[model samples]
Target: MTTYLNSLDYARYLDETDELRHFRAEFLVPERDGQPLTYLCGNSLGLQPRRARQALERELMSWQQRGVEGWFEGDAPWLSYHRSCQEPLARLVGARPAEVCPMNNLTVNLHLMLTTFYRPTGTRTKILTLAGDFPSDQYALETHVRSRGLDPAEVLVEVPLRAGEFHWREADLLQVLDQQADTLALVVMSGLHYYNGQVLPMQALAQKARALGIPVGFDLAHAVGNVPLHLHHWDVDFAVWCSYKYLNAGPGGVAGLFVHEKHHKAQAPRLAGWWGYDEARRFEMTQGFVPMPGAAGWQLSTPAILPLAVHRAALGLFEEAGGMERLREKSLRLTGYLEFLLQDINQRYGAPITLMTPPRAEERGCQLSWLVRAEGKVLFDYLGQRGIVGDWREPNCIRLAPAPLYNTFEEVWRVGEALDTFYAASRPRYPF
Candidate 1:
């Protein structure tokens, strides 16, 4: 374990020695007063890689120079544009190249997967998920159930956290699965909770769900690039994620999905389009849809090329960083250092901050969600004014995530310093 200290000099020394420190220069961090802000919100939307703009321009030049010929002839053929993105995405999510495809945005991909996997039949027709999952997921499940002529209120099972708890326990998840085994058609949950920065036991829950004869899927919008995942080894039936967050693709960029190879035959969803057709026959101008063999079969349209260019540029950075394993090791120590600093703040001044995420390093990613007990909005605004870029959730929580790709220990220490000052200076105005 890397021993952390409360001194600024120690932070600078750690940053100076960091193996991944060079990566910070590759991104466009948001700045205040010509100084880079302490950007800790990769969980929301990642900072842009410096290469993204140039990659998009290369695609634009291909369109201009080759005209229609760009589809077949260019550095990146428009026809196979989305394919280049798949390999890196597959590696990130721990699936085979055939099982992953970058395509529609997160929710659209979720609906597409649900169409194929949420196979409702006699007695098994419910979707089990978290109550506070991303609202788009709730809406998708509800509308999909409605399309099947079933009442969402009747068919959807939402699990809430235990009273006063910030995250779900594995026992709570298993018991719900056990009690509702007979009624579950599909089990969909976040790989990591977006609200609390907590990682759920995706593999364990997946194994149990499969054992109960229920097909399981994950909405990995927060998990995909934040932590290490083995969707293939876990035997997850299907999964969906956007590329914009920890993957750093860009705002409103193309998204991706994963489908186990076992379902690649005729059972794959018949959601058809030109791109989803087998590449050999895709441009043949044929009749019926002869779908591509794997998760690529889920495509519904020709991919947006420029967004894909940005995605490709961003995904390549992970490959350059030597994958998530290297990042995870640093993330463990980085998040722990943040926690240590927060505790130090609490101990010294009796601050009112409460950690909402799990303390265990394995149960978290880069983020640490904090519940500020009083003047929550004030503390958050103070953070913003000081050029610290943590995200604010509803009511009273602030989420700070130090991306291993760009954030440094010096930044984390500065955040700790800011919070300590904010709490102590502002304490007299609020009731102690």
Candidate 2:
């Protein structure tokens, strides 16, 4: 239990002692009015890594020097380019390298994984998810269900948060799983939820689903690189994630997927292409589709080398910063400090704001969601004016995530400072 103080000196002391402090230099933080902004929105999109440009340019040079030969000639040949992303990603998600693959974007990978994993048979014709999930995941599930000729309303089971609650309870989730286990064909949900910044009890959920003979998967868009995951050990059947958010691979960067080794030999239905063919015989260009073993077998089209290059470069920083364990160690304190400051401001100002994210460090990663009454947009704009970058979800939630890799303790403190100033200045407007 670390005691937090609402003081700039203490924030700097925390930053100074942080083992991952120097990793901040590896990224290009955005600036406002000739000064670096306190970026706290890595949960939405991570800052570009300094080496990303060089990585992309190297691929560009290869394309310029060798047109058609670029696929087979370079030191990091385009033919096997996506492989460079696997080891680092494997470490982040806690899967065997063979189980992870960097390929299509998030939704595409979700659809692909769904096509293979969401096998509805007889009475077990349902997909279980959470209410208020990110829009993309919701759409994917609905569309996939409809594609299977099943009514989405009947096929999709959502475990709703209890009335007047912001976060879902683990017990409630487990109970729902137990009740729906007999009919569930698949269990797919976010590992770390997007709207409320809640870290779902994935291990428990997976264990329960496994015991009940239901296939389980996760959308790790908000979880991967934000928290430490053990997908393989948790017995998660499949998972998908985007790189732009926490991976810092730039916008629309190539995404990744994980297919448990147990499913490798299963005769599951897949939307396959030539890239997924047996690598040694890919050049043979024969008719039959024989997918390579492991997650690489999920590939469809030729990988976009430029994004893969950027992905590799961004992942390198994780290796240099000593991986998720060290990054998550700093994340708990950094986000914890921000939570403390927000609580103090709300307490002093008559509680004009509400925190939607779970209070426990174990129930979240780095992001914290705040509900600022009707003045949510006002507070969002105020923070923008002070060069504090965060996200505002429609209706009334502001999300601020101080990434452990590039963000500092001082940045989190500055957000608190800005919020404190806003609350103090606007106290007269509220009728407390």
Candidate 3:
């Protein structure tokens, strides 16, 4: 059982005994008022790993010393540099190394994945997704459908939420897939819901789509490093994600994709670039295209070396924490703690802060998006003024993600304390 506590000493004690406590020093935390800022915004942008600078410097020196020769010569050659990051990246998402590759940014990867999977034919022309998915994804699907000379209004099926509901009911989604089975070309599943931080049922959703002969893909931007995912075992057709958020790869770092091994051999309809050509004779100045085997074949151009370097530095820490399973174990506890504290405040002050994220631990990640019953931004701005950095989504949700990789129990306690202070000051004047 979790020890419910409202004291700072209790929070510190939990931190004192935490096995992952030492890993905190590995990240560069932001500060305010001459103190470490209580940063719970990993869902928006993750804190940088300390080793990222050293990793960048190493590559910068190699570039300075070797110039173009850096591609073929050096301890870490740039030509096959993307190869080194495969294992850690694969481990994070639960895929074989052959199934994953670091490539373009999030929306770009989403478009690439759709280029092959979102093939619309005679009757089966629509792409199915939830109503409030990240806007970029909605836009990607919109443009992708438009590119085929097909009308997006007819091809894109966004299921609306139930009456007064904040969460998407899986039953409602499954029914839409079944109802539109004949016309649905693809199902785009978000591994984690971005706004509310709810982790969707990916495996079950894949099974549903597969039963109806509809191919499914995932935009795992929020799910990649924040939650445990098994894309291969779930038989996920294709998936894409950005590394900058929970993976802590810095801003606009390299993203990755997973192509099920089954689709590797002449199956995917790739928009081929020279980088995606077969590695054996890539530099032959060849005219005909021979795609590289497996997920690496999706590469469109030479990678941005600095971002890949920074990503590897971040992955190194995940490996040190003994992979995602261990990190997830701690994540469950930290997020749960935040939920508990928020609930406690909800009852104490009679403040109607309803958690927008899923109630079940299995259905959520580190983030807890709370819907303030009234005047939400007031509480959000209050927290920010107190050096607690959380994200504010419009219409009333404040998202606080106490990332297990760097966030501690004590920081979580301070959030609760800050809320209490906010309530104490604002309750009477604001007429809550």
Candidate 4:
């Protein structure tokens, strides 16, 4: 309900009074021509935490100084290295520590969850998902269906957006779930749409699926740190996420998985590995795999210590910032300011752009996706040339997400200023 102004002074005033403003210094912002860039692409790849380097160095020292003993002798032992990330991750995604584990990348975890949950018994063989989902999730569903001797065309039930709409409606999505409930064995979807930045109604969807006896999961790559979640209360069966995006865990860093406590004791089929065996008896090199009781049982290999160090350091910042509740408050204001500026620009320049992200604060996170009416690429490039960093998707979408941890209100104002300059200059040439 705060009124936003287009002036730089107002932006600076907001930043000065901001409670989480100190967090901006914790990250290493990207620069162009020796000056800091107006970085607003955390949804694509987060800014590097200043502590990440030191965290990696600590792990390197453990290896250099302890050699073989490093596994047992360090302050944080290598054997339980992945355990360091569990609690913080749980807090971020809303689950118990035992329900979450840092492991392989996003797709690998997705396949594993699908394998365990997609028990398509006779007649109930379909997997419900969002149409135009991130390609990785789509591909994972397709190949997993094929591996199970089912036709993806028949087994994958996709809920499409209504014609000419940029996002899905909750009622429409729930209606499809109700219609397909009889045949659905699983409902796996993105917690937030990557392209349009819409936060789907996860709680409602999960409640409906549980009522219908269909197991549900989420690919929370875009939602994990960007939005608030309560997976346990929602009764989500399982979920997967990558830390490289909003987590700021460096590129290709260790990813995470969650399995609700209810499923921890289920006699489900899993693709097991040595690391997933009972920690107490793991070194026994036994004949059978006695998996760990919780989500940790999903692990596949020796923990990647270096990447985990970086992840631990990055997750620590969230804990220090008082978790997602505090961050979400700031994100609401940051994105709201950007929306206000864009609306002002559209009105002044004859509506040259349209916002694809939902206008309601509860329906989105930090991102605002704009659909440029003309020369989207040119406008995207113009922003880049001015040292403003945002990402462009094909056709006409440009996504700008200001991380509450590092981005300032003044930075959001600069984006508005730059866009105004571009559209004002283009008005004469493009007849806007």
Clashes of each: 0, 0, 0, 0
Which sections of candidate 2 miss by over 4 Å? none
Clashing pairs in 4: none
Q: Looking at model 4, how many pairs of residues clash?
A: 0
Q: TM-scores of all models?
A: 0.98, 0.98, 0.98, 0.99
lDDT of each: 0.89, 0.92, 0.90, 0.94
The digit string of per-residue lDDT tens for model 2 on 138-200 reads: 999998889888999999999988999999999999999999888999999999999999999
lDDT of 1 at 52: 97
Residue 427, candidate 2: alpha-carbon lDDT: 73
Task: Give a tens-digit lDDT track for model 1, residues 345-428.
Answer: 887766677899998899989899999888788889998999998899889999999989999999999998998888778667
Query: Candidate 2 — what's its lDDT?
Result: 0.92
Q: Which run of 10 residues does model 4 get worst, by summed lDDT?
A: 423-432
Q: Cα lDDT for residue 141, model 1?
A: 91
Candidate 3 residue runs with Cα over 4 Å from true position: 430-432
Candidate achieving higher TM-score, 1 or 2: 2
Residues 32-112, model 3: lDDT tens digits:
767999999999899989999999999999999999999999988999999999999889888999999999898988888
Candidate 1: worst-modelled 10 consecutive residues by lDDT: 266-275
Worst 10 residues of 3 by lDDT: 423-432
Best by lDDT: 4
Ranking of candidates on TM-score, top first: 4, 2, 3, 1
Candidate 2 positional error at 410, Å = 1.2
